[model samples]
Target: MKQRVVPIAVLAGALFAVNVVARLITRFGFDGDDTAQYRITIGMFATIGVILASVAYVRAQKSLPSEWLPSLAAAAIGGMLLTILVGPFLSGGYPFSAGAGNFFSQIWLYGGFAIVGILFGYWIATMLGRDYRSQSLKAFTAAKAGKPRRVVRR
Candidate 1:
């Protein structure tokens, strides 16, 4: 349990770190530049997507989705909450100081990016026949090949 908790915490911290970097860049380097800020936001989200996708792809190869997915989900949620609520303060702003529209849009973007990343990762794993389910199926078939099936009684 401690082992599992550690990885999830690390992933969540990583996500928050990404958010912090983006906020810092926006606050200092791109201040008063909406275009630059927008670009930074997009870049940050893309990075988040890639991070999650990588985690998904790697995890899918090692364990069943049921076993590992909750960890990933928890990490994402934890990261999102931290990024949304605590992140603004780092830039000397309130979470919703950007206005209600921007606050909600950020939520939408976070959820959208996270889902797409997970799907993309799982899709690639499935296509490569490296996901746990695919590997399990292959192993099952291989093992059954040497065994004779018992006839079912009516």
Candidate 2:
């Protein structure tokens, strides 16, 4: 349990850190500029996608998607919750001051990006024939092909 939780927490923390940095930049650097805020948000999402994709690639090499995907989702959700709830306070603003629509939009965006990232990573691993299941199937096929056939006695 610790092993699973620790890594997920670390992933979540790293993601939260990215969010904090983006939020800080938007708050301090951009001030009233919506354009810079939008750009920063987009970049933040892209960074999250890349991070998740990298994690998926690494996990695919050793474990089935079923084993690691839930962890990835949990990490994303945890980080997003922290970013949306706690982050605003840190930035001297209310969490839902932007209204419910914007709040929900954030959730949707984060979830969508996470799913896409994981899929992208897993797809690349499969294409490379390096994923756990792919490697297993390849080994099975190779072993079967290498086996000698027994002759039937008349």
TM-score of each: 0.90, 0.94
- Tens-digit lDDT track for model 2 on 1-154? 8988999999999999999999999889998999989889889988998999999999998999899999999998999899889888867888898898988888888888888998999999999999999999999999999999989999
Score candidate 1 by TM-score against the native. Answer: 0.90
- Each model's backbone clash number: 0, 0
Candidate 2: which stretches are off by over 4 Å? none
Q: What is the C-alpha lDDT of each candidate?
A: 0.93, 0.90
Clashing pairs in 1: none
lDDT of 1 by residue, 1-154 (tens): 8999999999999999999999999999989999999999989989999999999999999998899889999999889999999999999999999899999899889988988998899889999999998999999999999799989999
Model 2: residue 101 alpha-carbon error in angstroms: 1.7
Q: With candidate 2 superimposed using the best TM-score fit, by how many Å does residue 111's alpha carbon deviate from the native?
A: 1.1
